[model samples]
Target: MHINPYGEDPVRFAVELAVDPPSSAADLVARCRAAGVTDVTGREVDLDDVRRFLDEWLGVVDAPDEAARADRLNALLAAASAYPRLTNHAGDGWHLHYRDPDLPLAGVLRALISVGTALHLAGRGMHRLGRCAVAECRRPFADVSRTGRQRYCSPACANRDAVRRHRARVS
Candidate 1:
């Protein structure tokens, strides 16, 4: 569709989903709506499915190494029920859609998430995604930095980590 910086949006949405899953169907729909997921069905099952999807998706994000990463992601792709297709929705023009109607909620997510993650890594840089540098917070992130060297989840986290490191060095 519009591709509103597809590389960034999908990765960011994936990371966000991984960090804190939505509490309810409305919350899930709202979060997805904010992330450009148009036409959310506003159903409780969708939220539950997405929660499951995110937990599995986080495993993809947290895989220890590249090979492990591929293994986890490959499992998802293999299990996905939807075949890749080109379609457009809402006001967006033509783009890829890796799903078909009537797909189960989890299956739908497996397709969308797998395809989206593939596009994000291939189109963007493979190194664009990572975990936060803060030791206490293992949250994952998509590095959309212009310099391509972002190591922290947020400035606050960075600052706190820096202070911790400085204190450690001084001690």
Candidate 2:
């Protein structure tokens, strides 16, 4: 079965890109492929534009409250607005795409990231996306945990914080 592309994957990808942005167009394309994005072609990619778009997206992640987050995300959604359409590009089977056909890799990523983030937040919870609880490593992360109480970006960060707390108690 064809999985929905505009779902958890894109949101997770956004987090990955935000944490360590691609250094070049080739790097971006390679990372996209690594993240299961098969549609990217060797078209001229503008890394600056993608970085700018990602900065805007990070605003939603860093918003002070739910309302602010929604507002920021709504702006991005509006910017990437396109009527949903079905296609079987690359013989991947029919799937819904919320973007215009033949768009550049940057355009496609903007739409996917925006729509995917919306779906993730609406389907999961507004508080699902956040920064790591570790003060030294405030990296962004998409909390896909079943219990939805994830505070750190990774198990290591969580364990590090816990160990610090334990040491403090002992001292």
So what's the TM-score on candidate 1? Answer: 0.82
* Candidate 1 lDDT by residue in tens digits, 25-55: 6676677678776645632356667777787
Q: What is the C-alpha RMSD of each candidate to the true structure, in Å?
A: 2.7, 0.9
What is the lDDT, from 0 to 100, of the residue 45 in candidate 1?
A: 51
TM-score of each: 0.82, 0.97
Candidate 2, residues 54-134: lDDT per residue as tens digits? 999999999999999999999999988599998898795888899988888888899999999999999999999999999
Model 1 / residue 93 / CA error / Å = 3.6
Backbone clashes for every candidate come to 0, 0
Best by TM-score: 2
Highest lDDT: give the candidate number: 2
Q: Assess the local accuracy of residue 72 in candidate 2 as a C-alpha lDDT between 0 and 100.
A: 96
TM-score quality measure for candidate 2: 0.97
**Residue 19 of model 1: what lDDT?**
81
